[model samples]
Target: MKIFLATGNKNKIEEIKKIFSMENTEILSIKDGIDIPEVVEDGNTFEENSKKKALEIAKFTNMITIADDSGICVEALNGAPGVYSARYAGEHATDEENNKKLIANLQGIENRKAKFVCVITLAKPTGETYSFTGEVHGEIIDEPRGEYGFGYDPYFYIEEYGQTTAEMKDLKNQISHRARALAELKKNIDEILK
Candidate 1:
């Protein structure tokens, strides 16, 4: 069965592909020559955004579609940069820019509690949909500390691993927010594919 991943971000595509790998189940993304207009993410929550993207793409391609909306939510900031994680500094903000803005906003603040949240929505052409959510708790560090991963990975410190998500390398595929969410999806794959 073929599944359309409704996103153009290369990093997200790679991560999802790795976690959702299955025999006879092929995953395709925007990079696979699927031409669809970008979906606006004006939702107040991750689930809403994920469902919106999934439904839109499923309707357009008449295929089973999956979409995810994820972000770093800081407890101190009242979960700010939540839905706007991608464009925290501004629309089209680069990773570095968003990280910088996050650091600045967190300066001198002792409460560094934060969590990475991911919501995945699966949609069928008939508009039937299901959603899954996953989260990894961590603290926000002032200095970025890894050579791999993207987005807020370098700044997210996992106490148990003693390393940021970026430094975890392959281990990230097992424990990251997206990975956990995909794991949930995989558990129900048989029923969803029917």
Candidate 2:
């Protein structure tokens, strides 16, 4: 089965591919001759945005398309930067810049509550769509840790692992938000593709 993921981030694509592990599934991007129109993610929720992207891409490709919208929600901040995770700092902000701003915001605060959330949507050419969500609870650290992973991984402290997501890069295939979402997704792919 050829699955075209609606995303421009190579890191995200690679992570999803690793998590899925489907031999017949081929992940491709919009730049890979898919020519899917850019879907506007104006939704206030991750699931909404994921659906919009998946549906839009599926319409264009006339094939099965999977889209994901994810972000970090800080408990102290009342789940801020949730759906706005990618553009948390501002529109078109780099991962490093966003991570820096996040750490600055938590300066001198004790409650570093945060969690990563990912919502994945699968849309078929026939207009049928299904969604799945996954999350990993953790706290934000004052300083960034490790050099692996991407986005806010360096500052996200996983209580279960006692290390930041970046620090667990080698094991990210088993822990990150995207990985978690894919784990759930894998169970449904067989039915969706059929």
> Against the true structure, what is each candidate's TM-score?
0.98, 0.94
Q: Give me the runs in candidate 2 sitting further than 4 Å from their true place.
A: none
RMSD (CA, Å), each prediction:
0.7, 1.3
Worst 10 residues of 2 by lDDT: 29-38
Compared with the true structure, model 1 gives a TM-score of 0.98
The lDDT, on a scale of 0 to 1, for candidate 2 is: 0.86
Highest TM-score model number: 1
**Residue pairs with backbone overlap in model 1:** none
Give the candidate number with the greatest lDDT. Answer: 1
Q: What is the C-alpha lDDT of each candidate?
A: 0.94, 0.86
For residues 1-194, could you state the per-residue lDDT of candidate 2 as single tens digits?
67888898888878887787688667777657656666789999999999999998888888888899999999888898888888888999999888888888777878988989999999998899999988999999878888878999989998889899999866877887778888788888888777
